[model samples]
Target: MINSRKTDHLEICAQKDVESGNPGFDCIELDARSNPGADFKAVDTSTKFLGKKFRFPLMFEAVSGGTRKAGEFNKSLASIAQEYGLGFGVGSQRAMIEDKSVADTFKVRDVAPDIFLVANIGAVQLNYGYGVEQCREAVESIEADALALHFNPLQEVFQPEGDTNFYDLTKKVNEVCRKLKVPVIAKGVGNGLNLADVEKLDVDAIDVGGVGGTSWAIIESGRSGNGCRLFDDFGVPTVECLLELGELGKPLIASGGVRSGVDAAKSIALGASLAGVALPLVKNYFSGGAKAVEKWLSQFMFEFKTSMFLTGSFKVEDLRGKVLL
Candidate 1:
């Protein structure tokens, strides 16, 4: 059953038309003409997130947990994070938390000792009274710098064995944030958070896992054969979500449908501290191995640098509020 489940994720992630048609990048354009002689060499991609400095404004978004393959995948991801000097997030740790025997599946810190890592769990898991101890254990088990509570009720609702009890989820999340020693990030799973929601949350950062990339609804529908077309197009586009949350005065990480450095640059211009890519990285990791993944990430960072140069912005902070063409 576990093997088949992993295969299902692998297949759908690798071969499905999961990206939304109207990715938010269309709504934003950088004023590249403003800097005809911009120096690309001076562009700085450094960012301070959750009290730690990252050499690049990119994070390896969460991807796996539940099997031996997951362990191998995370190890490779950790190595890449260390090599590129970026942040990394693991997939939902619920499976491993429930059974210590599979703990190694979520253990990537053993590989990248100095890289910033974020431990993940579903917001719904907090309602079960998992408490600070469990949250700490997840982070300690990983030696993570932060904890990410993923909000994927839509995906959960679509999955056959998904959890339905979402009562007091925000309160539970707030409690978790208050209790945990490390920073807590409220992450959306391809259904980006709006400004209103962001204002009400107590998380230190927000991962706008917007629509346009890896539609969990479509992925879940594909896995279940439920044929719910309505869900296929749900969630805000990455650019739009970034714009909405840009004024919220908190660090934001952009995800979902962010394919290139331009996309990453657009995200930064729209107010994202970092841009994260998951499905593309996962596919590369599975097919071409670590070297393939490293090559892809290096290209992404290069693209971001190019965008920064074109905008005449030498630092990530300089990219903020810059006029969009």
Candidate 2:
């Protein structure tokens, strides 16, 4: 059941019109300076997150796992992270936990031994009998450097077999954070995280899987026999999530609708430690494989660097306060 669901998700996201809302990047404009402090060739995009350094402040957000096809995607995407020195995340490992035979589908250390890999698990799984031990297995199985406890109530609300019991899940997440050896990140699906949604999480970082990107609600709705469209556009926008949580002082990963490298630069300037992309890359992979994905990433990095140079920001840190709403 889990394996089939995983495949369904991958196909729907790649082929369906699952995007909803806007990430609000259009509302922001970089304050280009007449004198860029550094030369374009020398601009630095490197940054550290979860105790690992990345050549670019970007992450290939959780996309797929738990099937032969997903495993192939994981191997390929992890290799991309290795090549670019970016972070990579695998989809929920519950399928592997339930059926260990499929665990190989989520393993990628052979191809990407050094990238900062994040193992994922639905936080609501806590209510369905998952515990800290399972969290440990998720991290150890994939040799992940961090763990993302993704909270997707909106998506679950639409899932046919969704576990909607998110009650007291925060306490459970806090427990896992206290016991897990690796860093924990509290994440959202496409609905983004508000201050109230994240204040209680004792996570090392937060990935505001904000709106303006793939709408899991819409994806599940496509899977649903009955079309549910009312809440398709719900959730906080990506930029709003960053603005709401910037005061927390916790590192933020702006995801949800991140498309181009310029959007990533805008995210960094708005207070995100890194930007994450999923649908765009997955679509690229489905259409043109690894080379096509690599080409897109290359262009993305160039755009990001150009954004920094235009703003006269020499390094990732200089992007702060470089945007005007």
As for model 1, its CA RMSD to the true structure in angstroms is 1.8
* CA-lDDT, candidates in order: 0.82, 0.92
At residue 37, candidate 2 shows an lDDT of 64
Clashing pairs in 1: 29-325
Give the alpha carbon lDDT tens digit for every residue of 63-100 in model 1: 88778888888888888888778899988777777788
The numbered model that scores best in lDDT is 2
Report per-prediction Cα RMSD to one decimal: 1.8, 0.8
Evaluated at residue 6, the lDDT of candidate 1 is 55
Clashing pairs in 2: none
lDDT of 2: 0.92
Per-residue CA lDDT of candidate 2, range 1-325, in tens? 8888889998987788889999999999989898886679989999999789999999999987888999999999999999999999999999999999999999999999889999999999999989999999999998999999998998888888888998888889999999999999999889998798699789999999999999987898888865768888798999999999999999999998999988999999999999999998889898899999999999999999999999988889999978999
Model 2, runs deviating above 4 Å: none
